[model samples]
Target: MVMEIVCPAGTPAALRAAVRAGAHTVYCGFNDETNARNFPGLNFDRSEMREGVDFAHAHGARVLVAINTFPRAGDQSIWHRAIDDAKLSGADAVILADAGLLDYAARTHPGLRLHLSVQAAAANADIINFYAGTFGVKRVVLPRVLSVPEIAAINAETDVETEVFVFGGLCVMAEGRCSLSSYATGLSPNMNGVCSPASHVKYHDNNGELDAKLGGFTIHRAAKDEPAPYPTLCKGCFSAGGQTGHLFEDPVSLNAEQLIPQLQKAGVRALKIEGRQRSKSYVAQVVRNFRAAVDALEAGRPLPEGMLARLSEGQAMTTGAYKKTWR
Candidate 1:
């Protein structure tokens, strides 16, 4: 079967653009602290989600609500209500990472489908199966740490459908558990659904060169004419282990468009595109490109030629751990 292409929609316009560009599903979050990628002027209000769902459904695409962040202590109600509202808004399913929130939804909204978000970092089969059995999760978004063979091994051990990221930003640390951003910016993705938030970034000139700093730490610098990548903590240059470089990962975005066949053969049920903060044009272009790739693959044709490299971060891309070089 052809794998499902799930794209991110930060706005109603992006949602419509993804649908029109041939996304099988578009996932998004509420404009609150309840979901990751909680950036300014992005995400959907309840009304926007409802309208976005209507538009997607009208075009034969599905909407998946992402209530993925862990709830604050003594404040689980907000996350719970986001799930309820997503269902009320006619979302096909809700992506969740917290065990308590998953349990609550399993009990309160028994009929609703649950997809374990990548934020959970349930990489191994033991933990993946545990989540599947514990919360009745229908799908699992594997963390970017697994190789294709490792993913195939996990599929051999579990019945849970798997999803993997195929494009956009890369995280060097496990998605949900990283504190590098919080240690520097004082906002936690676990509690606040934000990482290296734009509000705390500053751009300045240092000795005739441009530098982008995040939370007072110099992340990326460029010569006067070179493009400076965004100051995301994971993609930043830092000295560690006597290496003055992007110790975790270079400032390269994930562009695994070439790995579609291996992933399909490995039993991945869906392909996820990161970047809810992207423009509608970007979202549409990515969806269209991936759609064409998947279509050509389904037709048993060679995967399309290189098309998305120019759109990548720092104009460079990597297949992440899917190819085992990072492992």
Candidate 2:
């Protein structure tokens, strides 16, 4: 079977671009805190979501609404409304992370398809099976912490479809559990949907050197002519016991294009691209390249080479935990 190409569409224009670029499925979120990538100008409104879903379906593509953030106490009405709106918007599925939200979705919208988000950190077979048996989740987006062998082991034990991130931002911590951003900005990524939010980010020019700070804490510094990475907490430069560098993780994006066949062998059903905050043209280019690669694999042809290296974060990429190199 051809691996499904799941692309991100942050806006209505990006939705059309991904579908036209040959994405089998495009995932997006509403312009609120219910989704993980809740940036200021990204994501769609209610009317735009309806139109985007209509457009994707008209082009023979599917749209999955991401209602993946954890709901705040005494304020679940917002999350519930998001689920209702997603169903009313003609979404093919709703990706969820919180157990309460999943339960609500399973009970309230019995006919709606549910996908387990990576934020749930359903890494093992038992949990994946639990989510499937309890919530009737049809698919689970595996967290980026698992190796190919680990994924294959989980696939051997569960019937739930597996989706893996094949490209874009790499998270060092387990999804849905990081507190660094919250510690710095008093906002949780899993709950508030903003990490190192632009509102708290500032840059300083110190004698021809630039310092990038997140929530007033300096995260990275470089010469004026050099590129400085965005000050995401995990990927930030920091001083440890004796050294100062990227103490947690380097600013490298995941690029598993070379592992398509291996991931397929591991029983992964879908390949997801991260970066909903990207431009429509970037989304189109990534969708096109990934779609072509999957098509080639289905036809038993050689996979394309060096097609997306230039698109990687900081112009560097890694296979992440797929190769188990960190161990």
Candidate 3:
């Protein structure tokens, strides 16, 4: 079977765009802290989620609700309610990370399909099989840390389907495990879903140069006319090991469209796009292009070239760790 093309939809409008652009699946989150991507002016409320699911189903696409963040010590009910709301909204599945929460859902909502989120970082077959056996997780979103050969090896050892991020953005650290943001700004991708949030960003004129500061830390400093990337701590240039450069990653977006065949050969069941915080138009374009790529692959045709370069951030793209050299 052809791998499913799953796209992110941060808003109702983006959901519609993704469906229209031929996404086989659309993943979104409720407008609450229960989700990892809980940014302002994004995500859907309960009614909007219901309507969005209905619309996507009408268009022959599935909706996956993301309740991927870890629950606070005393606020587990919010995440539980969000999962219930997703089921009521007719979502096809719920992506999750926390082990306790997975156990909770398995016991309470046994009928709903559960996909382990990338945030869980279930990279090896042993851990993935453990989750499957323990919580009945049907699929696992493989973290970006694995190389293609490593992924192939994992597939040979497990029956649970694997999903991979094929395009848009890259996380240098393990997803949902990095606390650098919280350590810096008291907000994090796992806790608050905002990394180097705009609220804490400051740009100053550094003597005819531009300095982008995040949480009082200088992330990027360059000539005023030079393009400055966002102050994401991972992509930030810093003096490390007696050198100053992008220590974690260059300001590049992931563009692994060309690896679809290899991913398929590695036993991936779905390809995920990772730009929930993007615009509706961007979502539509990416969904359309990726849809075309998957369709071509299914038909045994050549893949399209540079269909999304103009849309890439910083006009640069990377294959990420999917290639062995990224390790």
Candidate 4:
């Protein structure tokens, strides 16, 4: 089978755009904290999710509702209700990370397909299989910390379908456990479904330099005429050992277009794009490019060269931990 192109859809518009752009699958979440990417003006309302799923199914695409964030203590009903709503809305699958939610879905809605979110960070075969066996997870979205060989090895040991993120922002920390965002902005990705929310971000002109701050901490500084990066804690510049630079990661995106064949050989069932908070036009363009690339790969043609490089706006793009050096 051809590798499925799974695109992110933050809204009804983006969902339609992804489907029309040839996405094999589109993933989105609810507007509330039940899902990640809980940004303002993003995500779908309950009714919108139903309509979006209808639209995707009509276009021959699959819709996955991402109720992936961990439910807070004594607040399980909200997450439970989200899953029930997803089922009622005809979602093809529910991507989840929390053990309680996973167990709930498996026990309460056993017919619904369960996909392990990258937030679970289930990197190796043992744990991936554990999820599959325990919660009946049908797929696992591998974390960003694995190399090609590592991914292949994991695939060799587990029968669960594997999905890997192929493009967009890269996170260096373990996905669900990272608290830097909360420490900086009082918001948590795992609990609250937000990271570096725009509400807490501010940019300042510092004479001949531009400084970007998140929750009052300077994350990036650039020359007046240079492009200033958004102040995401993971990709921030800082001083350590008397050296000032992006200590964790640089302001770069991931572009794995060239590694499609290798990933295919590694038994990956799906390729995921990571920008749910982007514009509809951007989502359409990216889905079209990735769909074409996968089509070419399946037809035994070389993947197109530099098809998505321009989308990064000349920012650095890396293969990240997929090449084996960073681990």
Candidate 5:
């Protein structure tokens, strides 16, 4: 079977574009704090979400609402309302991470399908099966920390559907469990659905050097003519042992298009692209390429090579943890 192409839709236009471009599934979040990728001018408003869902359904595509952020104490109502609105909007599923919110969704909206978000970090078969057996999660977006052999092993052990990120930005730390952003900007990705928010980012021209700063800390210092990278905490440059460099992870994007066959062999049910903040054109291009590749794979044709290299961050791509050597 062709692997399902799950694309990101930050707006109604992107939603329509992905569906038209042949996406099997498109995932997005509410404009509020309920979803990750809660950047300024991104995500769907309530009305847009309803319309977007209708459009996707009409085009024979599935829409998954990402209400995956962890809810704050005494403010669980907001997350609950998100789940309620998603079901009303005719979402195919609600991707969730928090235990409390998952329980609420499973109990309150018994008919709604639930997916375990990568932020939940259900890396092993035991925990993945735990979420499935306990809350009835139908699918789990595995974290970007497992090798292909590991993923195949997990699939061999569980009956739940698995989704893996194949392209766009990469995360170094475990999803939904990183505290680096919170410590730097006081805005948690797990809470606010934002990491290294624009409110806390600043750029300075230091004479002949350009410095990118996040939360008053210099992340990268580039020459005047060089392009400055985004100051995300995990991908930032730092000094720990007299060596100043990307201490955690370099600013490289994941481009695993070449491994589509391997992932399919590993029993992956879907392939996900990771840029909800990207432009509609970029989303369309990515969706088309991935859709074509998977279609070719299903037909026993040669997979396209280097079709998305120009779209990779800094023109650098990695297989991430899909290969054990990356560990």
Candidate 6:
């Protein structure tokens, strides 16, 4: 089978744009904290979700609702309702991260298709099989930490489908478990669905330079003519051990377009694009480009070169851990 192109939809408009741009599947979240991209002005309302799913289905595309955040104690109802509403909205599947939520979804909505989110960090075959056997998870979005060889090994051992992120934001830490943002802002990205949320981000003009601060901590400073990156803790520049640089990770997006054939050979079932908080135009352009690439790959044609360089973060892109360059 041709590798599926899974696109992110931050809003109803983006959902439509993705589907119209030839995305085989579009994934999105509810407007509340039930999903990971719970930033203000993004995600779908209940009615908008239903409409978005309906629209995608009408266009022969599938819609997956992402209720991927961990529910707080005594507040499980919100997550439960999100699962129920996703089913009602005709979602093809609901991506879940928390095991409790997965169990709840498996028990409560037996008919609904379940996908394990990358947040679960199911990097090995054993855990992937366990999730498949225990929770009836049909698919698992593998964490970004795996190399292609590791992914192929896992695929060789598991029957569940595997999805891998091929484009967009690069999370340096394990998904759903990074506390750097919470330590800085007191709001858990796993629980609150935001990292370095805009409310806590402030930019100050400092002597012809701009300093980007997150929760009173200076994350990055740029000269007058330079662009200031958003203060996401992991991708921020820091002064540590007398060296000033991106100590944890640089602000670069992942672009695995060049490795599409290798990933297909590695048994990846879907290629995911990770930008739920981006604009509809961005979503459309990315979807069109990826759709063309995958189509060419399936046709045994050479993959396009430098098709997405202009769209990469800071005009810089990395293949991530796929090639194990960090070692």
Cα lDDT of model 4 by residue, 121-188, tens digit: 99899999899999999999999988999999999999999999999988878878988999999998
TM-score of each: 0.96, 0.97, 0.95, 0.97, 0.96, 0.98
lDDT of 1: 0.91
Show pairs that collide, candidate 3.
Answer: none
Candidate 2 — which residues are off by over 4 angstroms? 205-208
- Score each candidate by Cα lDDT: 0.91, 0.93, 0.89, 0.91, 0.92, 0.92
TM-score of 4: 0.97
lDDT of 1 by residue, 1-327 (tens): 888999999999999999999999999999999999799999999999999999999999999999999999999999989999999999999999999999999999999999999999998899988988988999999999899999999999999999999999888887789888898899977789888888989989888688889998988787877767668888887777886887667888898899999999999999999989889988988999999999999999998876887777878888889998744
**Tens-digit per-residue lDDT, 157-200, candidate 3:** 99999999999888888777887778778888887767767788
Q: Please give the lDDT score for candidate 2.
A: 0.93
Pairs with steric clashes in candidate 1? none
TM-score of 5: 0.96
Candidate 6 wrong stretches, greater than 4 Å: none
Q: How far in Å is the alpha carbon of 198 misplaced in model 4?
A: 1.4
For residue 296, what is the lDDT in candidate 6?
A: 95
Clashing pairs in 6: none
RMSD of each: 1.5, 1.2, 1.7, 1.4, 1.4, 1.1
User: 3 or 5: which has the higher lDDT?
Assistant: 5
TM-score of 1: 0.96
Clashes of each: 0, 0, 0, 0, 0, 0
Error of 3 at 249 (Å): 2.3
